[model samples]
Target: MKNQQLQSKGYLMISSTQTIRIISINETFDPQGVKIVYGQGTFSHYSKDGLVEDSIAYRAKGAAAVSVAEAGVNASGVAIGYLDIEVKDSDKGYKNKICTLVIRSFIPTTTANTTFVPTTSAPISPPASEENSKQLVNPVPTVAASNGYVNTTDSSNIPF
Candidate 1:
């Protein structure tokens, strides 16, 4: 058997569903956080009936590079974590498959607070594309460096 390498591209045309989890965030003028998000990507294939298929296997692993000030203004975690990714699809036979998906232009609609787990509190679940004015308190605070706590975000200034 020959060893095979694979890569594919999925396209999200018009609109698609996406979900992102903020693993960790650091305090800074422009705070950067790690995120793992998956959503319906570009159409990688089509059925015999001319129906298109969206790939959920592909994901965008990137940073939530937003500012505390910006977060305060938006008052939405989903808005703060919004991202635009451009990369290959992580699916079987993707490398060998023909790619027609526009990876760079994939954007979702109506991002809201679906899941949030503060360090100290239980998980917070809110509806998508809605506003929740609940305050968030960091249950487990991080160590302070010369600058300050990296994962620290002033709850008073933010709305969860």
Candidate 2:
């Protein structure tokens, strides 16, 4: 019999606290007929000039799917948490590596703060009234001026 070498064990890759605005959550059956749930959103942060946005996604299955649902990620809203990825052997083969999102703590339908400083190049005005403000789905969070870092407050349940 030929000896087969095992692939390198899976390990965490990148982990960062991010403010995500979940645009949609989708559920579908995989090729194996297993239910898979995932979501697409935008990751926003403040730069030296102004707010910046980027697309983000997460896959939550099994009990994690339930937790994501409970966290209210099913709708369009803001959530802040540690978004991390793990490099692991793909289900198809050991030679391939798959990056999977490791769900940490996510508090949904909430804003980290209510302060925003628009870029000087393109100025943006705040909502005119309370009614108008209520319609804004993506609310800017407060970032530390010195280093552009925002604090994550809801970490009581986070393991690390």
- TM value for model 1: 0.21
lDDT of 2 by residue, 8-88 (tens): 344333555555665556777668765556777677678997988867777655554554565554343333333443356
lDDT of 1 at 108: 30
lDDT of 2 at 37: 62
- The sequence of per-residue lDDT tens digits that candidate 1 reaches over residues 51-90 is 6645323333343333212222212222222223335556
The prediction achieving the highest TM-score against the true structure is 2
Query: Global CA lDDT of candidate 2, please?
Result: 0.54
| Candidate 2 ranges beyond 4 A from true positions | 1-12, 29-35, 70-105, 109-160
Q: Considering summed lDDT, which 10 consecutive residues are worst modelled in model 2?
A: 1-10
Q: Report the Cα lDDT for residue 144, model 2.
A: 45
